[model samples]
Structures are given as C-alpha cells and as structure tokens.
Target: MNHDGHAKNSRTAYTHLLWWFLFAQGGVIAAILVPIHVLVQGILGPLGIVRVVDRHYDTWIRIVGNPIVKLYLLVLIAVPFFHFAHRLRYLLVDLGVPAARSVPAQVIFYGGAVVITAVTIWVLLTTVPISFG
Candidate 1:
C-alpha cells in the first residue's frame, strides 16, 4: 500500500538523519578535543621540558575532576554511548534479527547506556575531590 510505503520511507529518512546528526556531533567533538589533547600533551608540556607522561597524567586527572571539564566529559560519554547503541542496533539487524526484535534490542541498549552514563556522570561530579590549593 502507498501508506505502508510512505511509512517505511519516513522511518528510513529518520534513521538516516539520526546517523548524520550523531556523526556530525562526534566529528565536532573530535575536532575540538583532538587538537586540545595534542597541544596539552605534545606541545605545551614538552615545551616546558617536562616528562610528557607525568604531565599528562596529572593534567588529565585534574581536568577530569574539574566541574566544567566533567560536564564536557559527561556529554562526551553520553553522545558516544548513544552512538554505540545505535550502531549496535544496526549490527543486530545485519545479523538477521527481525525488525521487531531489533527495535526492542535498540531500546534496551540505549536504556542501559543512559543509566550507565548517568551513574558515571554522578560519580565523576561527586566522588572526585576538587581543591583550589
């Protein structure tokens, strides 16, 4: 039926849009984080003539423990988890699961991802101690 065909087309379009949106989001994060990470690890720390690993370890922990940085980390973790869940759903479909099966699998996968992300964000925000000293 034309209605059925249209519904399928709409679903396909939505799926494609979701993929592109997530992909672009990830690309933007990578563009920002990669350069910052490299600069901190490669250029600035080394220019200071300090051991890179020691500097990186200390700096990374401090950055992760900072409130603003932790917030960014939460966003980073959450987006990647959602992206992973979506990709896993497609993998399930490719493995020959029926669409009905795949839908529920996707739901459960994302639900778990959300719960984990929440817990991680909470722990990052609370468990880590911050000092201006």
Candidate 2:
C-alpha cells in the first residue's frame, strides 16, 4: 500500500531503529573524534610537530596491543564507517537512483560496513606485541 507498492515494507521498526541509532551515534562520535585523530595521527605525529606516544613504533605497538586501546581504535574506525554507509545509501536514493532502496543496495552498503568492521577486528586481534626478551 505504500509508494513502493510493497505492502508497507516487511522490514521491522527495530532494524530501522538500529541503523538510525548507529548512524546518529557514528555521526556524533565521528564529528567529535575524527578531527582530533586526523590532526594528531595524520599531521602532528607524522610531521614531528608533536611528540605523541604513537610517534615511535615501539611505543605505538605497545599502546595498540592493549585491549582497551584496540577497542577504542575499533570504535574510531568502525562507527564512522557505518555512518558513511548509511549516509551514502540515502544520498544515492536522493539523487534519483530508484534502485537505491532495493534489497541489493542494502546488501552492498550495510554488508560492506559489516565486512570492514570484521576486518578491523581481525587486524586488531592479530597485533601481537613483540617481547623484548
């Protein structure tokens, strides 16, 4: 009965709510954290403008091997990834791509996010610290 002629879309409210929640949380976290991350990691640390713990490979390795830091890094990378996927999906729809709302589009966008998140976790898990013994 809806505009798609698909009987009001069988997708439940909770799924929509989940995506919206991730999108909103991702946006806020990205806006607050991404800029600082870029400034510190991308610019200052590499350029030697600031001496951060991550400036040295040894220190960086030690820091990243910590579970807490790994979790933080996952949040830093994964949250905005979902946010971007949702935003891009809607952007395509708004740009008159009628197929953007289709099941394939959902699979492509959200599935991509899921894949990337899994890869990030795998990489983080594989980061074994080198013992100085």
Q: Estimate every model's Cα lDDT from 0 to 1.
A: 0.67, 0.85
Q: Which residue pairs show collisions in model 2? A: none
Please state the error at residue 4 of candidate 1 in Å: 11
* Model 1: number of backbone collisions: 0
Instruction: Write candidate 1's Cα lDDT for 31-58 as tens digits.
Output: 5665865786678777995555436667
lDDT of 2 by residue, 1-133 (tens): 2468465677566877988898898899899999988898899988999888877787888888777788888999988888999889989999999798999998999899889999989988887552332
The lDDT, on a scale of 0 to 1, for candidate 2 is: 0.85
**Model 1 regions more than 4 Å off:** 1-60, 99-101, 131-133
Query: Model 1 TM-score?
Result: 0.55
